[model samples]
Target: MLPFPSSSSSVMASSYPTRFCFNRECPDFNRHECYRPGWRLRNGDFADLCSRCASAYEQGKFCDIFHQRASGWRCCESCGKRIHCGCIVSASAFMLLDAGGIECLTCARKKVSVGPNFRPPPSFLYQSPIAEKFNDMSLDWSSSARSYRPPNLSGPSILQYNLHNRGDGYEFNQPTSRDKATAYSTEKQRGMNDLMGKLMSVNSNNHSSSILYNQKPGPNCKVPTCPNVNAYQPLISLKEGPLGTQRAFPVTTPIETNGHLGLDERYLWHKANSSPLSHLHNDLNSVAPLESKNLNFGIHLDTPGKYQVVPRYCPKVPYKNQVLQNLSNESVSVVTPLFEKILSVSDAGRVGRMVLPKKCAEAFLPQISQTDGVPLTVHDSTGKEWTFQFRFWFNNNSRMYFLEGVTPCIQSMQLQAGDTVIFSRVDPEKKLIMGFRKASVAQSSDQETGLNNNRESSTNGDAEPIDKHPPTEKKKSSMTTTRSKRQKVEKGDLSELKLTWEEAQGFILPPPNLTPSITTIEGIEFEEYEDAPVIGKPNTGLGSTYSANGRLSAEQDDEEAKDEAEGLLTSPKSTSKHPRHRNGCTCIVCIQSPSGASPKHGRRCSCTVCDTVRRRRETLLLRKKKQQIEIENKARKELESPNSDEELRQSANNSGTTSKNHEQRHAPPSKAQIDLNFQPERDEESLSPSNTTTKDKSPHHDETSCKPPSSSSVHSRHHHHKLHVDFADS
Candidate 1:
């Protein structure tokens, strides 16, 4: 507990030190010594008032600060006295409007006692039936009875209205206040017993404990000598059991303290009367024991928040390899080892010898002749067969049988120490099937390197410090050596072909030997010419086709050219020996004509074949030109208008007009000179459908007149061209 300050102490002298004056209008609010003197001395409490307020209090003039100001304290609306807001008893004390003013804590309680909804506290009803009877007989057993006073009810119910409704701004009806003296006297006369009786009677039927509190002694009571005990019927039993069964049941009468229930008494009574919850309690004896298999699944993962339990351990995963069968059928007579053995270093190192186990030799080699060496074949892991000479030998010292000559097979499989090797006899005449698994690093590398390392370590034992190097460096060096050796073998296998001169050039004779020097003839045999005068034979009148050197002369060449042009001889340029062809040119000479006659040489030979070819070429050129024109026209039309109704109509008309123009252009003509200029103009103008329609009408009107003039003009023009051509040639 905090120590209480004496009246003379500075704390009591100025409780609210350095605090502002309660009155806003006070001039001493900001001063250091603003506390009113002697006020605390008289009341044994610190004062909130300043010197000016104290002076006003002495002059019999009320300062508005006392009534209007709230200094952690408020003025009671009825008494006009300052009361601490924290000291308020209930919510009803402060929930007041300014016109109704604030009711003091004391007034608020008095008003609550007389309110319509107010009910007497549970402690007031906790009086034992014996105590109530004694009170009715006017016999007080305790000093509390004499000091007890009735609750005040005569005061106006100003603060009694519902405070909850005030938050919503609703008004409540209130009774008018009476004169102070009369109100006090009338309130003192109202007893608490009358109120308690009314509350008890009203709630008796609704509560289960009412009968207990209200029970009276019956005629058969054993405690009749004690009036209090007889009146309460202490020996009486209820349905479940006697009231004496409750521990400390006689002391259950509740005592009120600041409106709080007697919690200890109430709890004790409730514990004694309450029944245990039978359904909710678990029976520990019936629980099953934890199982091992289920415990594996119950283990949770170490990860946070996830809390996922591990799956059950499964042994089937590792044993799944047992399902695989041997290479040969089980029905056949075979030697199949149930388990493979790891090859040792001494066994794998030799390339020309092998030692077989006694069991393998006895099972597979029993029929072999003792004196003869047997040729055996063994297949490796990849199914590649290797032939080796095998012979069984019995050691005279050990008296053990062993098979030999597996070196080739072991070398082919590249077995090393710690590598597992298995053998199965698929066929007696064929090869023994062999399979192998690569050695684990720890087993192979450690065993092989340990020997080499030991030797090197022994050699350098005194040369270097023990901590000079680490084992990792030795391992790296060994690995690099192995890698280099492997790389060399790989390079040899994968390297490009190496070529020699004989193989690449496909000849073996030396360059100088192939070109031997030619030796000159020692003498020429000369025939003695007869001295008789040689007379030239009379010249045959035929022109020499070639000179003495086997070449044509200029005159002979000219004759050949002329003959070729005439289609009477073939030219030298023509490779074919046909007499009609010259310089690869196709003419009547080269092509067979329809008439079956020999062709005459000319640039413009009028043979049936030539004429037909010429006509076809002309028709092809015309058709190509027409197609090009149609493409250009279609592109132009598309550019001028997109696909629309007008374009469609225009296209339809253009198609019809184009057909009519084609018919007119190819129609049979009169035997007259055709108007070439007019024909070209008409063709060019047909691209525009609007213009073609206008030109088409004109053609229809002039058809009759135009034909006669065209015929006359054609005849005159042909006669003039023939006269001019004849004059120039002559």
Candidate 2:
């Protein structure tokens, strides 16, 4: 097949002509080489694999994404995620992982990320059936089977032992060197057979086929943490057995817990032995957590490892429309040039930013904030370094910075009141800064950037430096506003506005123009009585308190989180069975018109009216446009079909050349008959329009050559009217 390419021949044909493989899964096909086909050789028997693989072999190199390395297999952990985006459509992306599989920044804490070299070994929690299987297997973590890399896992017991033994460095029992040499091949071949047998046996039970891989061992490996394992045990934690711990390693096999029962009974022609991913039999069963959606989500991101944690793809804050409403560069003194309201993380979420203690490198920080643009001095919990040059992640968003480190940065990172914040190691490779969080005894600015939510919003991991904050001179209103300005701000900025992504929810989304639709909320208008007592009622917290737009100021809203939380404002008690709100409207803002939505103004809804209306209008318009185009095209075709003598000649010529055999089978019409059929043009007057009469006089069809004007308005108008509907039905 390779021209029997000997080492000499291969050396001679060093630039061996390349060949392409059509199969996407072929190890030989390189994404780069596929884009270039001319250099691709097409020797029918040149090579079995694609040119890329051949080239790689010829050059002695391999793709980092697929080749086995010191770390582990690079195959997808979310193998079952090969499922298309929706039932009807496929997505452009596949579930890919980074180099250190299962490495992901914690969405709740910017500083806490999991991956090799980034976070420490992960843990797991065990549940029922998995625990039962685990109970049958050995549970040692300090042995060589775990501490060192394992050999091939061939048979069921061997594979189970390997799986339970290896996912997190748990070693399996290996034979002595002489014994290994004597039995390695036979045992390995036997193991390979066992691998095949186990793979085949999958789906025969509740276990899925993807998890039945070149597996190691023990059913407990599938469960993140086993309930049977004691929680306080330092060696194996049963409760917190998340991917962050060693328990996440599949002791037995990778389990597909996302509910795709590894069976393909849909097709009559599909073979019993066929697999969806590849002919090479390895199970990629779901190992996602049963409770958390993200723990084992099937988003195919191209990270480096076999166990890449799915990055959370939540709806973004509506940043495109998010205007910095409060600040404009007006004439102000230099004391504090009206610090522009760049961006703020209102609650426990962190903004990613970077700080340099020494040489500059990108740091992936979360819990961002708009600190003073000064290099921050940091000291590590180890009391190692001072003025911590930390990195924070930003949306690459704006120059203004804000950070709210709600949770500490590291598992080893802890804080206590009166302790000093410090910097430790700066992981440039992972774009992270490690340090200690110190607590405050005195009330620092009461407002804090909520750093509890550690979300990663940066698209490309091109790290950024955080404009340093001067920690010593703390501004009174740095968290929210410059405590001085009571001048008010835009109403929209008052509340934490969230955007919804219809794509994630499997709903077709509207364009950027989409905003919360207007809903009219009917306000109760009251008539004042003439003989009423002049005693003013206790303000009722309504008419006198409302702004012109009937919306509260940002200050009032801020008070709601603090004041109402303190039981200062008790929730109104409901009296009726169907509990009517005092204002008759079920909404919080009584003055709002029922038709306009309160969501755009910070209120939740109990209706789906707007979405339905929008979908209907969109569908109607799309249908209308499609119909209009079809009609116009049809009219143009009609206008060109052999309408004149020359057109007739051209048509006849084309028809003649089209099929000589058909002309002979069905005898051609007689000259007289054809002449009569088109005799309507015989009358010179009828053959030409009034405007073309002069050109038609010579019978040369002189008007035929001129281009038709786009301004055929009369005809266009007639065509348009005939094609399009004038109005939409309500």
Enumerate clash totals for all models, in the order shown.
Answer: 1, 117
lDDT per model vs. reference: 0.26, 0.20
Candidate 2 segments whose C-alpha is farther than 4 A from its true place = 1-306, 313-431, 434-548, 551-730
Q: Of the candidates shown, which would achieve the greatest lDDT relative to the real structure?
A: 1
Q: On a 0 to 100 scale, what is the lDDT of residue 612 in model 2? A: 28
State every prediction's TM-score relative to the real structure: 0.16, 0.18
Top-scoring candidate (TM-score)? 2
Residue range 1-730, candidate 1, lDDT tens digits? 1111121222433543444332334554435355443222111232334567656643423223342332223456556554322211111223121122245545544544432322221111112121122232221312222211111110111111111112221121111111111212222213222323332333223223322332222222222211111111111111121111111111111111121111111111111121111100111001111111221111110000010001000000111111122448532222222123445333454544555543333223322333344555656656676655545554663223333556676666655433445544321111355555334322222222111223222243321111111123444434322322222222221111112212211211112112222211222111111110111111221111100000111232444323322222111222131211233333322344322234443559775554644543443355346545764676578777666645544443333233333212122112221221122233223323333222231121133222211101011011111110000000
Q: Model 2, 518-558: lDDT tens per residue?
A: 22222211111111111101121111110000111122333
What C-alpha lDDT, on a 0 to 100 scale, does residue 229 get in candidate 2? 14
Candidate 1 regions with alpha-carbon error over 4 angstroms: 1-339, 397-403, 427-431, 441-730
The local distance difference test score of model 2 is 0.20
